[model samples]
Target: MGAWGPGIFSDDLAADIRGDYRELLEDQVPDDEATGRILAAYRHLDSDEVHVLWLALAAVQASLGRLDDEIKARALSVIDRGEGLEPWQEAGPQGLARREAALSKLRTQLTGPQPARRQVRRPWRHVTDLQPGDLLARVASNGDTCLLRVARIDDQRVGAAPVIELLDWKGQALPKDRQLRRLRPRYRDDGPHRPMTYRVARLRKKDPDWHDAGFERVAQGLQQQGDDALPPWSYCGWSQLGDEVDRLVGPPKAAQ
Candidate 1:
């Protein structure tokens, strides 16, 4: 254990408090804000002391949020840290206990008559900037298919945990090193006001047909939307239940 300093609570109390905040950060409520707060919570610790923090942090960081893009980003980060082993198993149990305790307490505090958190509707934004490595999706409209990617995530679009999606990206399977002569942007519907969807017109792999092997693998990692927005998402599925709430509260109107 590190030396207990004056002014702060005893090392035990401080550790518990830090653990509480860390646990809270691991839960779904504060989602994005938790990253910065968790990093800041460790500010006082020396590098050596932070190793365990990083372990616990890395473990839960992957699944704590509902946003697929963010979850994938965090997973790739944590998995890259070489945590697929022993110490993780040892620390996992206690860490979950701490997480449970913290979130339970949060529910109590948040539900009190005077309550705490301000009412907010964080929703996921649409994805943009589709690339070779992204998972592609095709939605059906008017006998044509449109491609989409869950690209960006923010608190405003998805409250606490939100996701942003991008449409009009080519995610079709292409053979390695394939090149296309034309990129196709297709509309799902023939009628006016139809949202646009884009796909690669033709793919060639130094031969013929591009393979979407990589995208096919990543497709499982992405979250999908349905019957709601252009790219096909319900707030990126952060909470489909929020639909009724949104029904009660109308969407904001843009400036004319």
Candidate 2:
């Protein structure tokens, strides 16, 4: 089994993440900025978007040579900002013990043998560069891989962002009018929206090695959105309920 740590990544990629954090430090962005941004995303985004953001950040942190402190801080911030309440928060000593026991059990489950993660490559940086037939990666709530094929680009002006039709690996178009949107410029005005900015990279894959019935389920879930429209995560994967809460409250591990 691969050791429990950050996955392998190119030096250039690792340097890029380091550079981004360094710039944030240089610019004097508050340490809570990352945490705050994550909280904002949790508040504004749907379940799938939340999963994608968490998974992507976990991947980046893993690639960063295991900067445990930085990763731990971000996770703790999410828990705190989300206003989580351990039983102890209200139940006193008894609740504290229960919470600790629950947490310990969860840690064991999370650290159990996990399936190998899909190996992904660098993706197109610009949305405009995407072309029909390109495959992108989407992560499910359980951290499974879902590959989406770009069918067409709809760059018309009428929405918050341009939409791209995507198909599953089995040649089935996602239900409804589901589409992928590039990170909008609006979020960049005050500062780079980490979730929005990194979404383009997070939602796409440079390789196509997935074939599973889960892809059909993914599409059907998006179709069920009706007039609501599917969030980018619909094209990607599902986020298991308790798993997400666990990660938000503690140091993140590879989604699992």
RMSD of each: 20.7, 19.4
Question: lDDT value for candidate 2?
Answer: 0.35
Best by lDDT: 1
Model 1 TM: 0.21
Error of 2 at 45 (Å): 21
Model 1, 201-236: lDDT tens per residue? 111222111132212223423333341233322322
lDDT of 2 by residue, 1-256 (tens): 1112222122233333444543443455554584355445446645423422333344443433322345444434433343223324655666555544543443332334433433332333323444433444444444444344333343422112223233222122332333533211112224543221111222333422122212222322222122133234322222222233233234434655
Full-model lDDT for every candidate:
0.36, 0.35
Q: Provide the lDDT at 56 for model 1.
A: 41
lDDT of 1: 0.36
* Candidate 1 weakest lDDT stretch, 10 residues: 201-210
Q: Estimated TM-score per prediction? A: 0.21, 0.20
